[model samples]
Target chain A: MKYSKQEYLDYVDKKSPDSPIWKNVLIAFLVGGAICTIGQGFSEFYKNVVGLSEENVKTAVPITMVFLGALFTGLDLYNKLAKHAGAGTLVPITGFANAIVSPAMEFKREGWVLGLAAKMFTIAGPVLVYGINSSIIVGLIYYLIQKL
Target chain B: MNKKLGKQTIRFANGINILSYASIAGQKEGEGPLAKYYDKVLEDAEWGEDTWEKTESKMQKSAVSRAVEKAEIDIKDIEYLFAGDLLNQCISSTFGLRDFGVPFLGVYGACSTMAETLGLASSMIDGGFANTAVAVTSSHFCTAERQYRFPLEYGGQRPPTAQWTVTGSGSMVLTRQGNGPYITHFTAGKIIDAGVADANNMGAAMAPAAADTLATHFRDTEKIPQDYDLILTGDLGKVGKSIAIDLLAEEGFDMSENYNDCGCMVFDIDKQDMHAGGSGCGCGAITLCGYIMDMFRAEKIKNLLFVGTGALLSPTSTMQGESIPCVAHAIAISAKGE
Candidate 1:
């Protein structure tokens, strides 16, 4: 119970779950590539079929992916797919949508206010707070430089 | 009047009889090898409750009432109830037995709650404070996850050192007289902290406490591991069990032959992929009240030592990067004179 630091580190290393490196890499590659292809398809559809400009197409694609991710999560389909897809389900913007929806759904039983609404930001909360705050700081710096 | 031995052991002159017991497990626990030991296994995790906390309360209530029923005693005759859970305010026990009409004593030893409750209940009976008492504890996977670590929906990766909290409740009745395993000795544990801060690795955090308690119990009683048919720890899982073995060996005691962990025994580690195996307040409680009781009834074991280990850390404390403080309480039960 009272092992040295090196022994403790060894114990952790030995107990660590074995991950099949090549197999995981293959799955990640195939899955991640497939998600990107779908995004490209959406962009093409918006540009050609809907006649959207490149700027609008860029905006529409991420919105569509996030919607689909939330819908899949609601249907309880994303987690199942994530099992096989691994990092594939997690690498895309849809994964970000899933990060919000999953915890929200899990806490729904605690009631809408304290449970779902409060927990909706469990995973994405930090990202949003830092991302927005840093952008505001950067905008200030840019304006100050222009004035100088 | 005093049975205290050395620093920890308490020998009950008029051994307390374990009247009866009951265990209730969730779907995942039911699927494990010890399914048959449980009195009831819920097919759904919610157990018809709106939240996991409510479900845990429901389980404790069921386990206690069924244990009393099995003892064939009138509900009004039960004098005291000792129960707890891995929840804030020990809400599971408070809300679960709100209608039992029995005087309640809420205790907390984290995963070691069962042993602590049993030790206290046995002392109460042996001290003539109560003729009949019940010890019950419950833990649910979902409830403990959100409370101790993270939201169930986080889908965070668990390391191999991590243990799955058993979603179950186990209850036992202790009476002054009965035909069951007799509580012969109880050894209280000292709070031991080895400065381990990682919450995920509970086995490591609790192992030193377990080793210290076991060594103290042995020294106080002037006995060794071989004296008992079995020596079981509450929920050390695979990793902590090995560490305990090494630590005991350092003290010139070898426990390889009879030592086992409730965590590893509750679930098939390889098959269930439970990593380091099960850990929770209910993990040891159910295994002892359910599996070990069945073994005792079958006369396969004459005596045993049960040490319930617990990592006493709250989410707030862990979030603030405080080290996990741990404890292990030991109880000696015998069937030799029965």
Candidate 2:
């Protein structure tokens, strides 16, 4: 009636907090740092390649992380780390990337255009919506404040 | 049956009081009742700073103490005990209760033990056999770790969608023609195989059992999902819960609203910080014996159906490449009267 391994895994995740280990701590720093670096690179690339502005790239960093996260998540690489580090992959700025990539990957099998593309944003759709909404408000406020 | 014509001669059903219960009283011994039996694997079992004996004994006895306190019954008064655990001999439950000195009935129904014990005790009362009996089951981390996974000291990663094994225990007292809680009906699920063999992903592995039991429960009882205020399953986590919604929808039932899984419900996500969910007999048992009973006693929920799902496929069975055969036993725990 109960899944032992599954349940035990849950217990491990819950009861044991983050273990202080040099290997994992360093791994978190490196991987997290690498992801951030990639985000900066992507933002610059998008601005240069797609003719988007710096501001657009700034916004795109989060969007990029969300996409990359989903991609890695789908590949199960992020899930592996998420399982081991518990909060490592989950706590990163790239967690949004894993989130988006995972769901998109999950649905990608339904087909690229219809399934993958449509659901690519499923997990992060709320974040996207909130991002867009808040951006509009923030931009308006910033412009008004600066002009005044 | 509709002979309510003369007088509303309606009195609650004569129920049984569970006299005593037992569990693995874990400690620093690093061994449970079944420890000797697990000699081969004991060397491999590991725990964190918290030893298996510690968590298990602490959990098992805590429940024993709580049950004694709540029931207001002295330990010696308990007439019988029906108990089990994940261990070979159900040590944490059996050995822990050794001092309680109640007549014991050992049962191994995997995660369906709560129902198994309750079912056994209920039948004893219904058949006019025994009046007082206790049903208990417990699982400790150290003991379970050695048996199932690498030693905690080994430090290995777990899979996604994995739920923590509950190391706690719960005991209930069932007395004959009693004034307290009574088990109304029992509906057991058939041994169902959906051909899921992955042991790591138990949520998917146990999904069919949960769905099938839910289906069978609805089929056998002629009760809709809406009939009960809460339709609870033993240990299907978020993944299985999603699948259940889709499965139930095929039968024109939607459990999206009043539906909660014991695995998902037992712990506070933020508080316990559990990722996917919880597992083991205690997951559902404690939830029922602890949380649900309190709500039921307070008249918060009038009628409830608890369907505890268990993956009958063991390590040996699964290692034999057998698809998980899951079974769920459904029991109706209602208020004093409907």
Candidate 3:
């Protein structure tokens, strides 16, 4: 080693270009806000025009977004949008839909059982596991407080 | 009497001649600057194959067959086939070339497989072990992305330092007999880990190794940067190319005038939106086989220093927080053999 690892890392940091975080963040914010706005539109339509209950509207809005996400992923447009949109497209329900559908479509050749069914959770499985587990922990803490 | 030069360099007594070479590029590569030089460019990434791995295999097969055809020789006439790819178990080379029934040696040097295979094949031919040999390597954008990074459809932002894996293949037929453009020397690189841990910034990881091998080649061959018309590295991209230039300058070798990287040459980085240009086995392979070989045939260059750089890190090793270990092999190609 001509230089220490720290020195080499410092040199690499100096040489390598950094990603445009501000641009990415702005795009992500706009795209995310747009997606949410569309979801709100759907929510309003279902609640007023379709005469759905508040609970039904909540379910209907996400279902519609997930459907659009899966549809865009199937059409192979979501990833392209996400390329520039970054977290704007990824932090929404549509992103969750894309996460599942993308791998499902990709692994379709590997067969349905192991490829599609098994590997479907490659990205979403961790989120589900942690989300549910943390919610359970929070519920338990509330339950203890109520008992006290 | 010894063929071995100072340190890790080998001066081939009988110059290994490059008979013919071919390059097969995918749709993305076809849109690049060297698109016209490629022997064949597929309009689709899948290449009508069922899978990306199979598509990579098809590319290797096409490149090897084309090179052999251009050489005006039957596949059986080729004694050995040195090939590899970015896929696990080198599936692209094995599955692609298996039907050819040529004696095969699978090599692995990450993106440097082209130079590694070429160097080994040239040695075999120069040492009279084989009359003719073929060196080939391929990499697919789809296969490499899914295997090395994330799912193709996974919506994750790639850093600016991230390089697009080239979807292409290149093959060269080398023999004991040919007109010109002979491989005169081989400098085997030592694996050097400069402790770059980021997997996305491969150029940074591999730059130090490229510099070391180039400096060693110059010292062993008693040649300077001015001796070669062009000094090309495999896939060091923009960042690594500049870093390599600085590192070599520190070693008292000024390469600023004639130095370029295959990574930077293959793609129109700004226009194509290729963040750090191109990388992968195919980057060096196709650039050498397509554009560089055409330059040789046109007599644009005489002496050339072709260095293939590779970052040796697996997804598992990277996840384990291991730094990328890199190597670069240099092959001196000249228009005339001594």
Cα lDDT tens digits, model 2, B1-338, are: 33111221111244344343333222211132222211112222222323454445446555766676666777676666777777766776765676677787888767777877776766666666665666767666546655554333221245545666655566777777555556666665567666666665566666666776777667655678898888888777766666667667776777888988877875554455455577788767766775677666677887777877777766578668876777777777665633
**Native contacts conserved, per model:** 0.23, 0.04, 0.77
Best by DockQ: 3
Best by lDDT: 3
What is the two-chain DockQ of model 2?
0.03
Clashes of 2: 39
Regions of model 2 farther than 4 Å from truth: A1-148, B1-58, B270-273
What lDDT is reached at residue A66 by model 1?
Answer: 91
Query: Candidate 1: deviation at residue B305, Å?
Result: 0.9
Candidate 1 DockQ category? acceptable
Predicted candidate 3 versus true structure: per-residue lDDT over B1-338, tens digit per residue: 79999999989876899999999998989999999999999999887888998999999999999999999999999999999988889999999999999999999999999999999999898788999999999999999988887778878889999999999999999999779789999999999999899999999999999999999999998999999999999999988898999899889999989999999999999999998889999999999999999999999988899999999999899989999999999999999975
| Segments in model 1 whose C-alpha atoms lie over 4 Å from true places | A1-30, A80-88, A137-148
Report per-candidate DockQ. Answer: 0.39, 0.03, 0.77
* Model 2, span A88-139: residue lDDT tens: 5656666766655554554544588986688667556887799899999999
Candidate 2 at residue B57, lDDT? 46
- Could you tell me the TM-score of candidate 1? 0.93
Docking tier of model 2: it is: incorrect
